[model samples]
Target chain A: MALDQSAQLSDDALLMLYANGDPGAASELTARLAPRLLPFCNRMLQDLAEAEDVVQESMLRLWKMAPDWVPGAAKPSTWLFRVASNLCTDRLRKRRGVGLEEIAEPADDRPGAEAQLIQAERLSALDAALQTLPERQRQAVVLRHIEGMSNPEIGEILEISVEAVESLTARGKRALAAALAGRKEELGL
Target chain B: MTGPNDRIDEFELDALFEEARGESPTPSDDLVARIVQDAAQMQPKPASSEGHEPTGVFRQFLAAIGGWPALGGLATAAITGVYIGVAQPGLVGVTAAELEDLDYVSTEIWPSDDLFFEEG
Candidate 1:
């Protein structure tokens, strides 16, 4: 398939093409999914390197699973997110003994605009606050609020009911607010 | 005793989430390249005619007879039958002419005298 045509294809369609050994399909899938997946993994793992690893592993699994993938059963992106979510959970479980403060903060490399710096700081604070949340709540909040996914889709990714998803996000937001309560003045919120 | 004034409101938290959304980390080019490479390495090969040609008649016949070993066994059995008929080895040895002269049609399989003696 041509690159343009592959770009226009749906994730399920691309996966089918990939199973049939179309080289273009893999690249198209990577371009479509990697960007979305990386940040979600990064948020979950709180480490860019680990997040990158998770994304690569998840995509590898997707490639292996392409042949057996049922087209209408689930969206490919949802499946990918679920894989990444479970991988992140496993990593987090292994990290139980590690302190959150010990996780290295990502360096800011952007050109310094005063407003941009403020925005970055606020986001950094939000990320730190997010780490304090329970894993399920953090996942729900990130998927619902930051990723702008619907509750039903977040439920699917987290393997929970939609009502449970709603409850998680609510509790997660409350925890985040409490964690960041003192920083309101400093963050200029 | 956390006061209400100390807590960040819902609006403030929402604004922070909005910032976080806008500031999602972009994947490094190296990471993207690595993922694509993995996909390439792991992908299933396409269904193609090259390795999947239709079963030929010879192959079907071979399969039906349970392949080369069975064929060898059958050939051996056939050669032995031919050897026995043509060579006629003299181990216990009735000659071919005597064997041919033996009457087959008038031979009684069960003799009446033997049956009457066994009954008595």
Candidate 2:
């Protein structure tokens, strides 16, 4: 199928096409999914290179899974996010010994006006605060607030009950609020 | 003792989250390229023609006849029969030329020269 036509296809359809060896399907899926997964992984891992690796590996797994993917069993994006979320969790576990001071700041390469800079600073502070959260809480918060996913969907991704998801996000927000307590005036919030 | 002023309010937190949502990082071109490459590498190969059942009537008929090998054997037998008929090979102890020179006559079931037949 042509790229434009495949773009109209659902993730499941694209995956079926990919399984059927449609060359355009892989590209279409990459275009559709990578951006969404990248930031989620980045927010979870807080390392661009590591996040990129996780996203690539997750996508590779998706490609491998295409042949066995039952269309109606689950949404492809949901499955992809679940895989990525787990991968980020594993990486975070491995970095358990690392100190918080070693966590690299998000690269700010964009040239913008003062207001844009302030917005970037606020976002950076939020990201740092997110990194301080426990892995599950961070995943829940990012999926809920940052990724704007529904609570049930976040629960599905995190393999937790919706109530648990709400609890985590609630606690996560409180932690973030406390973490950024003194920065309200500094961040122009 | 934590003071009320020390903590960011829910309104402020929500604004921060909104800003963070707006700052989603894009996957770099190189990363996308690598991911596309990985997908292409890991993709399942297309289902081959051998895996599909024969569809058309002719194809089904061919399958019923045991496929190409059976058809080849049938063709060979046909061609050999035609060769023996046209070329008149002498393997059967008689040739077309010899059959042409031979005479065939009708024989009666009862001969009138028999004495019992004359009396009857």
Candidate 3:
């Protein structure tokens, strides 16, 4: 039997292969990491279109950095998230007047029929509150809370101490709760 | 506060993180595909080699130009001369007599100091 992914080849191993010019490794990394990055970017930019742009740019950066990518130096997912965070922050700073999307826009325009009517408002509120967070806190929360990276892993990706990641995530969660707490009825959850 | 402090252990924070993470919204397949396509196209080029160049007369010339400062200065001077040669006379186009008469009706640029500096 072929070995399972986590046992046969971890992300770092695949990353090493990618650094050595394995196209398959690159595709595998893309397939695995894209899902995690999409939500993280959507949370930060709040506009689905802009979030898509940031994630694309970030992945391009990762590919460019792959040749010199030190194996075991970073988890591919963590690195992608960090790069995506930085990209979104750049847009947030540069794009004047851009803000969180309004929570009430109907989700009918999207192609996927996956937008659940029940959790629609709650999810939108959560997205809006996430958009309002400070860039670093938002990054820390997304990597830690959303991506489930360890504190140390986040610390490495963020170039900070584990304690700092912890502190940032805690403060971020509090801010998110405060921002979304008052909108229960409108959020419907 | 029962925040991520002494009261609330890292495990609790970790658990909440896991729970919250599970609520992640899926991205449209189209979006992921577009981004991945861009990424696949953006594979970084391998570093180029500047070393081990074939030695030749041009290489010897470059070597001597640096070794002899005067030659280096002469090369720069020649380059500057060529630039000036191409550029200086470009301003002195010979307009046809009728064209000049039509154009020069206002400005006294034929053979006067105003041609050099007007509106004194």
Clash-forming residue pairs, model 1: none
Clashing pairs in 3: none
* Model 2 CA lDDT for position A82: 98
Off by over 4 Å in 3: A1-7, A97-117, A182-189, B1-23, B39-120
Best by DockQ: 2
lDDT of 3 by residue, A1-189 (tens): 123553468878876666664556666776677777887787776677787777777878887787787877667777887788778878777654554354334333444333243554445545556667788998888877777678998898788999999899989887876664434334333
Q: All candidates' TM-scores?
A: 0.74, 0.75, 0.57
Worst 10 residues of 3 chain A by lDDT: A100-109
Q: What is the C-alpha lDDT of each candidate?
A: 0.84, 0.82, 0.66
Of the true interface contacts, what fraction does each candidate have?
0.89, 0.88, 0.35
Model 1, docking class: medium
What lDDT does candidate 1 reach at residue B17? 83
Clashing pairs in 2: none
Q: iRMS of every model, one decimal?
A: 1.2, 1.4, 6.4
Could you tell me the TM-score of candidate 1?
0.74
TM-score of 2: 0.75
Docking class of 2: medium
